[model samples]
Each structure stands twice: as C-alpha cells, then as structure tokens.
Target: MVSKPALRTGGYIFKFFFRETKMNISISKKGISALLASVLLTLAAPVTTLANVKNPGLLVHAADDEATTLDPAQVEPGEGGETIILQVYDRLLDIDPYSPNLVPSLATEVPTIANGGISSNGLTYTFKLRQGVSFHDGTAFTADDVKFSWDRAMEMDLPEGNAGALSDVVASTEVVDDFTFKVTLSEPVADFLNSVVVAMVSSVVSQDAVEANGGVEAGSPNEFMAGNMVGTGPYKFLVWNRNENIQLEVNDNYWGENAKLNVRVEIGGDPDVRVLGLRAGEFDTVETDPSFVADLEGADGVTIYTGGLLLEPLHIGFNLNIPEGSLPDGDTIPEDFFHDPRIRQAFNHAFDYEAFLNGPLAGYGAFNPHYTPIGIFGHDESAPVYAKQNYAEAERLFKEAGVWDEGFSVSVITEEGNLFALMCLVLKDSIEKLNPKFRINVLAVAEAVFDDAHAQNPLEYAMWAKNADPAADPNFYMQAYQHPDGEWGEVHGFANGYKDAGKVAELIDAAAVELDTGKRAALYKELNEILYNDPMWLIGAQEGVVMAHRDWLKGFVQNPLWPRPSLKFALFDK
Candidate 1:
C-alpha cells in the first residue's frame, strides 16, 4: 500500500515570547568577582530588563503557505492572501468570525429589503457608510472611495483574479453622497450580500493610495497593491518580509475595537517543522493536521481547538476533453477519455471513500455530494452520495462501458507531497487492483505548475485533484462548478459530457436570481440529484478544522467560513 500524508490544514500558529537581559557590572578591583556574582544571580533567577525592552502583546504565527499577493481583487479566495486581507482591510459588510451572520463593518448596517437598504426587486442596494472612518494612510473613507474601489476591481478583471464576484452581478456602483453608496445589479441574486458583498474581493481599498501606486488596468494585476496594503481595519501593515514573515501592528487609530495583539505571520511550509515549533513553545499555534492531534493533545500548555467541518471539500475533476498531444499515455488513452458517463461513474465507485474519511481525515469528515459540502447553503444530509467503494459495482460498470478487457492508462495530476497527491495514490491503488490491464499514473507536480495547467481551457490532464473554494451560498458553487458556462464547466467541457447541459445551465441560472429561499434551495437540491446520476467530479470527504495553540492564547474562534487559519486575530488575546 502507498503511504498517504496528512492534509496540510493551512493554519497560522502565533508564537509569542520575548526575552531580554540587563546586567550592571562594577569596574572596580572586584570586576571579575562582580561579573561572576551577576552571572550566578541570572542563572538562579529571572533578571529585569529596561522598560524599553519590555514585551508588548505580540504573536508569531507560522503557516504552510504564503500569500501570493495582498491585492484583494487579485488574491485567490480562501488562500493565505485572505488571512492578511481580513486583518488589514475592512469590507462594506462582514461575516461574524464565530457565526455566518453578517455584521456591519465599513457600512453603518447590513443592507436589507426590510430596512429599504435593498430594493424590492433586489437589483439595487444602498449602503450608509460609517462616519469618521479612515484608511491607514489617514485619508477619510467616503462613498466616492467605495465607488472607486468597486469600480476599479470590476474594470481590472484580471483572468486570474477574483473579480468575477463583482463583475458577475454588478452593473454599476454610484455615490449618492459623501457617505452613501448605491449598487445596481444586472440581476436579482439570492445570497448576494453573504457570498459577494462580504467577500474579500469586495473589500474597499484606499483610492488615493491605489491611484498613486499602480493604477487599475484591465486584465493586469496592480503590482504595487499586490505587495503593499492600506486599509481601515484593526491592524496596519507593519512589514512583509517576503518568504520570511509578515508583521502587523495594532491600529491605535482604528474606529472600532482595537486589536489586543500585534501579529507576526511566518511562512513555514513544512508541517513537521511547524509541529516541532508548536511542541517547543516556539509557535503559539501551527497549521495542524488530524494526525498531529494525537501528538499535541497531551503536550503541556497546549489546547486542541476543533470546529465545524469546512465547506471546502477536495474533488477529483474529470476533464471530458483532454487536449490533443497532452495525454500522458496517448497510445492507451483517447482525448475524449472521460466523455462517457459510465466511465465517470466507474471511477467514482472505484474510490475508497470510508478509507479516506478515516485515514487522512481521521474520521472528522463527511462524504458530501458534488459541489455541496456540510455548512454550505445547499448541502442536505439526506442527499445520496458515494459513501464507500464497491468493487462489484466498479467491475460491472467497467464491463458495461465495454472497457473490461481493454483497460486504458491515464495520468491524473496533483500537487507534489500533499493530501491531493495522496488521494490520487489511493485512486491509483484501488483502480489497478481491478485488472492487470487497468493502469493509472499519479502525476505529482509543483503547485505553481499544477495551477497553471489547471487554469487552461479544455484542461490538459484527463483528471486533476484539488479542493473547492468555500462558499456561503449555493449560487456561487453552481455557477463556478456546475453551470455549463461556468469556470470549471467551460474549461472541462462539461457541456459536452453532460446529457442535458442546457437544462442544467437553465436550472443554475434560475437558482442564482431566485428570490424565494424555498425555491432557490429546491433548485439546488434538484441539481444535486441530477448531478449524482451524471457525475462530473468525484466528491472527496469534507474535513473539519483542528488547530493546536498555547492554552494562554484565549478567544481563538475557528470559523470555517473565514479564510484558512480560521481565527480572527483582533478577537484574540494572550
């Protein structure tokens, strides 16, 4: 059996400690005796240092990943970039770190139809901006800045950026007054506030700062903004030592509750190193794994923090149209490899779901249906799913697909030395056991290379492994993963593979604009059933979050809805 490593549950382990020593030595005839006496005293007990060297409230965090860019519009959602963005920038609206409820941030209140903040038709939204708020640059926050920031993000719709969150619904953003902002959507979108407004991509940036730096350009990332940050949150950007650590200091000038502790986020990619640091009191917290729970649960001064299962679940995406000349084994596999529904179903049944849930996930996960996981709006516990592997079903499907005797070879890609690669190895082991003719190659590549290839039109690989970005609403999931014209759908050519692509697209579009909660949910539930029959991706288990932190670190709330390392530093105190 191929050994699989634990999931790199990206985390921010804040290790806080400071030591300083001061010694007074007499330069008399007894200099050697005095120095020896002072050294003995220091060894016996603690020595007091100067007031200037006294330790302030500070935390040093280590993580498995680093921020690719600080630009809110450019950063990939749910990545390391978000942890920094939420600390440094404030959105018009915010989600409570402990709950899914929306909270007022830059805006005076969350816009709703009941308060006339949202239009009856739901296309228009008006926000009453907070007064006396200022960006890190000391510029007044106003409706004009709000409009400029939103407009700039929409205009600079870089292909790699998360601008689609805004560009997809917003038709225009208008400033009614210095403190009033209005947004008109092209269509009435259900859960628009939770999914898009509260998202990091919709975060308001300093208009003056951005204009002075690299101005907004369509389809191009602002290099200046990517490296620097200026916002109206509880923390200010102190310094970002690339590939080393990022430091943030408490913003004394913040309009809201001030942050209790200054944060220093270090980039530590190796989980073993992070674990060692946590055990040695070198890290207050670390990006923890389920496997590490056994190691750290009994360690002194450590607390294991576990929260609800994350909405994000890893999936094995099947590409219907593998590009010509890109197949790993062209002689054995065809370009239209996963175009057959039976083949997709066969692969789905071939995976050992229970093993994965208990193995790498440590039984803290659930087998969710495609595109819907626990805590997501559309997720239903009653939904049918592939709960376990059935070799009989796998063999029967292969025979039905007429590939029992002529088994094919194909390569599936994943990031090297990660849980996704391990999942691929699991799939490889199970599928190969069916027949000697069946062959599978797990192609592990660097993350950058994998991402670059994953982003290609009509994905080059026959299959690839990765997780979905967490979303509060079903519309975002349907559009990105289920809709025929959506990101993965268009790229993987699900329109060609799906039996009724037009019908699926229709239902997804209807769900997005559906105002009635019952109707919207019903639409998604229907899609879930339809998709289960015509599977486009293999649903991996959804893992809950578990972090190990120093017992002294209080008020650590892990909200799966927030970005990875799920704690909000402002709410924490040591």
Candidate 2:
C-alpha cells in the first residue's frame, strides 16, 4: 500500500495526497444491483455537479447513539466513542500543543506535595482550588464541587464502562473552605498533579447539578451531556443531536479569548450522503475519505488539510493467559491460554501494519510509532520498531517459534465496525498467509468480546483500548499490561507486564522518582527499550482523529481533545 511521495516540501514535511483503499472486494450478490445501477447512471449522464455552500454553522448529522448528559462529572475522561467531548468539557490544566507537556488545567500550577506532600504514611493530601471560574449555569464554583466530583468519580459506584479509570484513587474528601479542600489518597503518590489533567471534575460540573441529575451516581449520559455542555470553557453548548450531530456556540462569559467558529461541529453518518452533498457544494466543512483525496483536488475553493496521527498512537493487544496465576478471586488462569506462546507470537508478527496506514488510514497521521504516548517526552527511536507489511518475516518468526501446526485456532476480538476491528482483519489475512492451516475468528461487538476477553482466563483479544491517563504518567499505563488477578481489566494478565511485573514495577518506580529531566529521560529511555524487547502491546500506526466536515468549513481543525468535540474551537470566518 506504500506510495511514492507525489509532492515534497523540504525534508521535514512530505505531503502525501491520498492513500488508495485496498480492501479485497469480491462483488457480492446484493451489491450487484447497486453496482449495475451506478454503472447505468454513469453511462446515462455526463455527471455535472454544481457549486454550493461549502460550510455551515450549527451543523447537524445523523448518528447512532446520543450521549446521556453534558455533565463533566459524568463523561469526564470522555468516551473514545464521543468525538466532541473536548468541545463541551475542558480541564483547568491543558496539553501544550507543540511540546505536549502537562500543565495547569483548572489550577494555575501543579499542586505541590510540600505545601503538604501527601503524607508518606499513605493517608492524606490537601489542595487549594483555583477561584474566579464560573459554571455554565452562572453559579459561583466552590470547593464543595471539587470534593463532590472527586468523591463521586473515584470512590462511588459510577457507570461501569465510563468510570473504570478513576477506580480506587479517592479515599475521602473534605471542603476546607470556598476555595480549599483536602483529598485523602489511599497511597502516597508522586504524580498527584497527573490527577488534575483528567478533565477537571469541579471545573466543569457543579455540586448542585450532580444531585439534580444523579448526584454521586454520575448516572449514564443524558441530553445534558449529549446536546448541552456547560463547562468553564471559552465556548458554551448550543446543541448536540447525540451521535447524529452537534453544534457549539461561543460563550461570551468565557474567561479567555472566545473560539472563532460561528458554531463548531457536525459529525457521524453515511459517507455517500455527505460526499454527494459536498460535491454539490451545499456544505462548507465535512470529512472526505483520505482515499478520495484525489477527487478533492482541483475542486475550486476546496482545501484538504494535511496531518497524521502523531499522538494518541494506536495498537492491537494480545491477551494470552498463563495457567499458573490465580484470578483476583483466586481462580486459576485457564490452561488453554498457555497452549503456546508461539501462537501468541504469530499474531504479533502477522500484522499488516503498513497496508492500512498507506491505504485507509493515510493522511490521518497514521505513522509507525514507538511505545510512548505520541508527542510525549522520552520517546526512544531505537526501540524495537514494528512497521509495514512483514508477511515473510512474520512467517519466518512463526516457523522459528513453531506456530505452524496443521490446525491453529484462535479468536480475535474487537469492537465490530471500528478501525480496530478493521486492523484485526488485516492481521488475519497476513497470519493465514503465513500458516495456511491457521484459523482466525473475528468478533465485532464489545460486550461479546469483553465476555471472552475478560473471562476468568483469556486466550487473546485484539486491540481494545487500555484506558488510563497516559498524559499524566506512563507508570499506570505500564502497570496495565501485566498478568493480574482480575484487578484492572480482564485482559491485564495477558498484557506485557505479567511476564516480568516485578522488574517493570521497579523501573517505572525509578523513573517516577527521578525529578531531573536528564535523569528522568535516561530512565524512560531504558523503559522504552525494555518494553520494546519484551513487547507488551503490539503497537500500530499512531492515527489522528478522523473527522468529516462540509467544504465551506475554514477554521475547524483537529483538537487534542477531539476524542469528543466538547473542547473543539469553531467560529465563523469574519
């Protein structure tokens, strides 16, 4: 799927126009009718498409699901499924674009432990909440909201899927005053500042609102979250059609310079519906498939922004379990998991990494990435790199590892219809090529996949998200890929950490304690190298957020928080 660069701008910037789609398509019986109809239309009309509006404000699209609410306390960490989380909700701290460094979200500075270092005895930590911020409701924000949100998100029983990340961090909370509160950490922590980077709790959700909506429950998402967002952000919520579409109007009451979009956002739905609409020029901004980037060329006034997935790197996971370990409840890992490490190794080598990147994922910043959070400090280029289509070498590895038995059966799990599932299909093709006898089963639903993936013991699950605050610290992320007693996620035991958890723990701890950049960098270097050789996760192309907009759009660009539009900046061109 690799293509020679059609245009180059200096050595640093290579402009690749479009990557062609390469999915194997054997004409289907059902598609034949549509294919013939298209062919007949092509012959009948010298298609003359007309010009129209390129972008429009307060865009509406049709999507499948609607968020439950706009309450930050509810969808705070934000769902990967919700592309607009950032547009509606923002943190007090922010990610510096160029350096991607962590800094104040709600607070002006990182809270210092010395002001009261969380007592080494693992008892308590205290902080002063930043003042002057107001909630969307116009109520004055206070310390109680902080205590309430923290207690609600961490200690309480929140939604199972959305609230998994904050499990166990809070022990109790106390509001010292209108602007001061104390949080008791279950354990003394070095990266307590990392906690704030999580979409700030009180910064977006008020204490009273929580009680009215669902209180400490932080109940499932509702219209408040889906269509209406109320945070201390530069823009206020205008409307959201759940998954189908959404729009964000400016908040003149914002604390900073307001976002420029007359309204920012429109997303989700049929590609052809958007395509024909865009070609007619009825819309201003919308996504055009990278493969169709060629068609977009020469269309007057159309500009296809160029970028790639430089951060939020993607990866497929292997979930092989060993028999010796006990589940958290003391049940033993199933024996089938250890049937052979070579089988696990085969899947790793079989990935068709380059094909998808240069094809469907082209132009989205889908590049081969090393195992650090994209754009983070301490990324080591020398780490064992996984790149391109390596069918031959993957086969060699399979043979060398003895995975070529006559009948090898394994199930690959991924959420159906997602890019991750598509990646699994690519790997399946490559693996089958290596060992003609190998059999792969692809499962698309998350619930079904989770059932098998999170069972008492697992054989394997392809790249499902390993959720945690990677921006805050890699320690928790590193801790995630290990054999576990069912503590974190069911797949924990199969991740890279289980093989040598003790060593991984030691190195990660050492890296955390070293404050000096030079020392921290050195330790991190060692960590990436260790992780590379040990290979916890099968890293994939770091892909950027894929979004669609009408051609009239000018200012809309990918936001770091594009995971959801809640944080997106959009204002009309003057």
Candidate 3:
C-alpha cells in the first residue's frame, strides 16, 4: 500500500546541519587556517558586497498540511492540492484569472459552438495543443501526452482525485495527430469544456515519465510520481521537505514567460500564527480564516481579498442507518430514529439560523437552504426558506414522528475547530430547547480521530462541509449529496440507510448529460426541491473565503470557483 512520507522535521534539521559542517571538519590545519583567513576577510568586506546579492523572491504561507501527492491525476481537488498543482502543471484550458470565462492555456484557443472546435451536436470536442512545448523533464508535449494523462485519470478512478469531474461526461478520446486530439462524450454536455478546463485533473503529463515511474496501472497514490513532477508549467517540482516546507523553482524551458520569483510554501495550520508571521514580514502572503479578517484590516502594507459566497456549505448530515450505542460510551441513540424524514425535518426547523449566522459567522455568511449554494447555477432564488426558529413546527413534526412524548436524545459529532465546535454547541442548544426530556450532545474530537470515525462508523448526526469544482455548476455541487455512487452518499448515506436515496441520484445523472441548459437547470431545481422537502441534511450557511497578503504582492487574482487565490501570475515588486 502506498503511503505518504512521515513528517521528518528533526531529521531534516540534523541533515542540514551535518551537511553544512561536514566539509569544514575534513579540512587539514593549513587549509583550515586559509579558510579562517578567508572568513575574516569576508567579515571585513563592505556592506555593498551582501547588498548586491539578488533576493530569491516570495515566501508564502499555506493554511494547510503538506500535500498527500503532487501527481495531477492522483491529487485531491480544491485547496488541498490544487494550489500547488496549478504551479507545477498546465491544463488544456483555464478559467480567466480576471473573468469567469474559459481561456486557452496549453490549448491554442477555447472551444465553443461558434468556434467550430466543438461539434454542432456538442458530443465531440477537438483541441490543438500549442506547438514547441516541452515538459519540465525535457520531453516534447504532444497529443499523445494529453490522451495518456486523461486516460490515466479515468482508468485509475481515484475517488479523492478530480477524475470524478470528467468520469461521467467523457466516453473516450481520439488522438488525431501529434498536436491535436478529440474528446467524444457519451452524450451532449453543455459544461463539458468548463469541466475539463477548470479541473486540474485534465492537466497533461509526460507519457514517458509515467512509464518510468511504474505507469498509471501501478494503482492509485502512485509512489513514484507523488514526490516528483513532469509537467509543462511555469514552475518545476524541486523538493518537498515533509511537515516543514515545499520549494519550487521556475522552469526556464517553459513555453510561456516563467514566474519571475521562485516560491517557498511553508506548511502552517494555525491562523493566528500565520497572521503573526505575515505581520512580522516572514510571509509575503497567507490564507487566513474569517476570524482574522478584522485584525488584518488597515494593517501597514497588507491587503485582504474577500471572496463572494463560497460554493461549499456547512451542514448537519444524518446517518439513517446508525445502530444503537454506535457512538462513544455513555451516549446512546435509537437505531432507526433518523430513518423517519419527519425527524430530519424537525431538526432542520429547530436550528437557530439567525443567531448562528450573525453570531459565530460575524454576519459574513448568508443563509443557504439548498444543497447547492446561492451563486451557483440552478439555485432557485424563490425556493422555500426554512425558519430560523420554529419550535411549534419542530414540536409538531416530532409528535407526528412519534418521538415527541418520550423525547429521544442523540449526540452530534464534529471535528475540532473553533468554528465547527461552536456550531455544534449552537445546534445542540437549539434542539434541546424544544422539550423537557429532549437532549442533544455536542462531541468535538481531534481532527485525525474525527476523520477516522467519519470514515469507519459515522455517528447518527454530524456537521461537515463539502467543496465543489471551479465551474460552480450545480451538476458538480449536488452530485456529492444525491449521486448513488458518489463518495459522500456511499460513505454517509447508503451506509446509514437513507430512504429512496437512488431517486435523487437518477435526477443528477440526467442533469449531468443533458445538453440543453434550461432543461438541465429544471432537473437540478427539481432535485433541490426534493432534497429541501425531505430534508436529508440540515442545510446551513456559506462563509466567504478571505485571504491576506502584503501590499507589495501584485497580480494575485481571486477566483470564486476556487477556495484560495491563484498565484500563477503573482509577482513581488521588491
């Protein structure tokens, strides 16, 4: 089984110290004396001697752990790996940094119905790669590389990877020539190009590199390519010092103008530490939590970029199949309590949305009722809204479900984070206020333990968040909750015995392949209505993504589709 290299902070420091001093100890007495004299001369050297040396450029602080893998086909999508993958790989098409439209990158131009690149039926897409491009490893990039990269991603079918974005839409690919290829879809899909360009999984990789590195058939978490990279992007993979930092150098052989500065991405999980580091000038830019926004405002030489509503939303999920006493000792819930839709709907109405949204969220988040967030397509503005506090309705639903008299008690599990833990407490308070015997417990566990519990045996009720693709398409956002074969449903829904779970999955499948935009939107809207009524999840609010950077940093574009800013075109003035 493939596994990530363990964090070796102490080992790295020891090796660095030993390597730096090893040569010094080997010198003879006469050579040592000469070196000492040279050192004294350097100490006496003019200040201009050191001042003339060039700066290596920017130092960035990432608000995440070390990446699990760097291979485009195997890396998890979103903030976890996309931030680094964008710097090391180039895709056939890309979203415009300044706009939402698709733009040409490795491909010569954007394919559209009017551009003739897309067939009239929309089932066929043809692309011409930019000529004279070379990978970081010096292999010439061709149509074969594109085919091989996409085929590898689909064949591997890694659930955590971005392969899910295209696995449904793409049927197969045909290499027309060295510089051109065509993608044939099982059916016409309007968002096909957007899906390909916006997803890093579609980034081309060197075919020769894969074969040398055990090939795609070697299975997921490919050990060889995880630590190495062979892509045609502006930056090349240098080294990843686990738990410490990742270093990247500019690719001089790049087809386009390379980044003027090399990047050093340091791993840091504490938002406060990142803020202090940025203020101390140790970091040129950092991803910050919403709580840090107020402190960062008006600081000297600092600029904060706030995003619009995020596509991801935090919600409380129900494990309908949860068994009695499945939770930690001393916390026991009925086995089939959540199987009734009325209980789920009661919990939905019992939430104090206004207090939570305005209090913990600092009024920065908006109430979201549907599985799909507000800004994404297919979101119905006029959809029925859930009341912030409806004790009467909640009581009525509980009674109708035959649980109001006895007043059942259950616990809500969440990972340890200030915001998440606080949300769990707020939910518990709201639900318990309904009846005298009603009780709701809040359980906050360590992130690692929580992840294990969530994967192994999900609690009866839990609060969590989900991320969507850059396209903000409803087809991508809603699939996680509705698709029968989806990772989320398979793990959290089917395992817990959700009622008629396959109904929504059928709707999602139809919307995914539908060619007409209006029809597809209708299908999604209908699906959202069904979920809103059934109340599979107690949908919550969506917080805006906030980031902080030094004022001298320029050209950093914020894309709403992504959780973080894109630094591919970012530069340092000094």
Candidate 4:
C-alpha cells in the first residue's frame, strides 16, 4: 500500500505526506504551551520595517488576521479590515481581482440596464467618475468623494460598522458633476452591482481626507478615521504597528498603475509562525492553512495556489437561545437547546461529512445548503445534503427526539487555531461516537475571544462555529444567514428556532426585492427546499481557496470574490 506522491503547485494538485506532523494540532483548551509561545514569539519578532523600509521594494504579507480598522466606513466582515481595504481603498465598483466580474474602479462604467448606468426603475445609479483621480491626501477624487463616501456610511451607523452595506439599500447620495455620481435606490437591489458596489463597505473615502480629519458623526467612530488612511488606492497608508505590522507605500499620487510593491501586512498569528516566515525568506506570503498543507509541501520556493469554490459556507450555528446561566464549565445545555426540529435533524444527521472533508478541509471542500452557498444563484445541485454519514439515521433521529436514552451535554464554540478549531474537532468526534451518553465539548476561543462570545444576545453557546460572508448574490446569503429577522436571525433565537419561522421570513422577504432574475432564482430555490426540511444551520463544508505564495511572488490573484485575507496588494511584484 504505497501511493502518495502528488505535488504540482502552480497548476494545483497537492497530495503531500512526508510527515513527522501533518496536523495533530489539537486545540483542546489551547495547549502545546500556547502553540510553543506563538512559535517563540514568531521566532523572536523584528522583521518590521518602515524607518527606511527596504529589500527590492518590500512585500511581506504573513497575516493570520490583524487590521482592526483603517476605517473604510468601519470595515468588519471577515475583517482584517478587508486586507486593509483592498490596499488603501477606492471601491465604487471593483471586484474581478480574478473574476466575479464588475470592474470600473472609482466608477467609470458597470451600472447596466445595458449601461444606461442603471435606472430603469432599478431605482437610479449613475456613476461615471474616475477622471483625474488623486486622493492619497492629494484630495481631488470627486463627485464629492462619491457623496462623501456614501454619505459617510449612512451617517456613521457604526454598530460594528459595515454600515449594513450602505444602510441597506441607499436612498440618496447625489452630486452629479465634477465627474458625476448618483445612487437613489430605496429599493430594487438585484445584487446591487455584485453586492453593494463591490463592497469593501463601498469604499471611495476622502471627501478632502474626511473633512480634514474627523467629520461625519451621527453614530460615531471616526477617531481619525480609526487610525488613518486617505484613499484612491494603489497603496498609500503606511503605518499601523498595533499587534505589530500593516504598512503600505507606493501610491505616489497614483491614479492608475503605480504600485510596484511596498506593503507589509505581517501580523503573523502563528501557523507555525506563518510557515516559519515562509521557509525563512521572511515571508513573501503566508496565511495558507488547510491544516498547514503539510507545512508548505516541498518548500523550496513555495507556490500552492489551490483556488476555486469559495462562496464561503463553513456553518454549524444551532444556538436557539442558550442564555440562562450561559452554559460553560461542564455545559449542561437546554435553554431550549436548539429548539428541536427532531433536535435539529439529529445534529444534521450527526455530521461527519466525510470526516469534515478529509479532516479540517485538507481535501479542500464542498457541500452547502442552508442559505444555499455553492456558487451563489440558488445553488441546488439537487439540494438535500447531509453528506451521508448516517449512523442509523443519527440513531433514529436521536430516538425520535426524546433525546436518545436521555443523553445530551454540550459546548461547541471555536476559533482557537483556525478551521474553526478543526471543525470543533469534527463535531466532537462525530457526536461522541453516537452516544456513549453523548457528550461533546470543544470551546477553543480567541478570535478576540470568539468575537466577544459571538456578540451575546443569546449566543452564550450551545453551538457555534463560523464561515459564510463572501457573496456575490444569494441575497446576502438569505439576509445574513437565513432570515428569521436576519443576522443570525437576530442573534440566534431564530424567533425560537425555525419550524416555519413565518415561512422562513416569507421566503427571505421575497428574495430581497426580486426584480425577477427568474423570480430571484425561484425564491432562492424555495429557500433551499425549505431549509432542507427545517434545519437551521449545520451547513458545513464549502471551502477551497488556498494561496501560499512566493515563487518570486508575482501578481497574486486568488479571488473567491476577494475580501478576507484575499491578498490584492496592488497586484504584487517582487
């Protein structure tokens, strides 16, 4: 039984296994001495630069997530501030770093109704700017800086801002001269130009560097544009240091292509210190983990792109209220413990989904349904997917929901060391190997303590895992993960966990104002067959979009609709 050689790299094949350790990274209550003291403080830090930054015009990367805010109307949505607002901001339509199509940076064309710049009752859009550009503090990029950067993100509606992708359906932002701009829209969205003007919170910035630094108020959070950045793109802002790194530099009044290289990013959250600083060339690029692709396979010059399927669907959720005495130390569960739809279809037929797509997605991924995320537009490759690991139909639906021999202990949470703590240790080893008095536990923590216990409202954990925020359509993933009042259904209560939750919020509010794109893909393929028979999230596995870098690091563009650490350093160079 000897067959394992597969490598490839630039054309993507990868099958390596020359292991002394190919993932035994057990994240059980964070041991391994805090991951070997974060890999010896990422091998004794100090690779920093910017007091005369150097080396063939700099290019670092190394990220695992930093950038809390360089404030492109307060970033947040897979925040590393969207790889620093896709390199110092400028989005009035952009996507297509490698293809979800819409291009026209700082708006020059893509509006449609066959380019009448939209307004055939699609509630007006009109852009046309991008003339002599200019805003890395040089000011002049107008239409009043796209109506003061979307009216200062809908008047700073910063509740952890992403300003509901422009306070959900704009409704006014005109300037119409000095290179014209318009907007209108109190409705008629139809994927508003691939989801909110190619969103990085619809960038644009610099209405004279935010009214000379500190202007737009209403809900607050400008604090000098949350750590300064002035915009117009092609790399500009150059200093962040918090948690160590984020610098950029090549914009020299950039209006078009000037950004040969000069970026840093580097806030390395140890994936073995970003593969030991990308095999010690001191990181040309890093943050690539499919359980650390055998520590960057044949590491000589490292390539590993492995791109493709990413509408980002990693699910697990389930919460349904859990607050009372917020379960933790020996989780006893039951604050309506996932409000039974046969105990949420017996934890979605006891999820093993091919051992989580060959363990923590090392076999890359697939399989998505609730809120339909495969490649967007109503993804129904014949819907129904439990990825077949039945275990006697999850022990006859946990003994017909009588909680199978009265057993149930909980705790799921995640985030500690990526892949949502290895898919919560594959759902605590597939439901405690199907009931040895079924207990499960995992917890993990640390992405800012699991985003402050996943923003509490009721999610004090009965289950929690992540992924899903990368969309070109699928009505903003059925209004923030299957609307029951949307946004994790008003923080996990899904109006007391769905069985009909008002007809899945009336077919996600009639597929978000459907302008008949085949009746909004038949009301999102009938809410993916009514949430695949009433399952309120367990959707797991939909990954694939790797990266790795440094075969002389030229023009990196792995797309997946570009956002989360999806590198776009002004189309790299070195």
> TM-scores of all models?
0.88, 0.71, 0.83, 0.37
lDDT of 3 by residue, 232-278 (tens): 98888888877667788878888877677787787745554455555
- lDDT score of model 1? 0.79
Poorest stretch of ten by lDDT in candidate 4:
17-26
lDDT value, residue 2 of candidate 1: 13
Full-model lDDT for every candidate: 0.79, 0.50, 0.68, 0.75
| RMSD in Å for all candidates | 8.2, 8.3, 9.7, 18.5
Could you say which candidate leads in TM-score?
1
Give the poorly placed runs of model 1, Cα more than 4 Å off.
Answer: 1-56
Error of 4 at 64 (Å): 12
Which candidate, 1 or 4, has the higher lDDT? 1
**How far in Å is the alpha carbon of 462 misplaced in model 3?**
6.5
Candidate 3 ranges with C-alpha deviation above 4 Å: 1-56, 158-160, 330-332, 457-471, 494-503, 563-574
Which model, 3 or 4, shows the larger lDDT?
4
Order the numbered candidates by lDDT, best leading: 1, 4, 3, 2
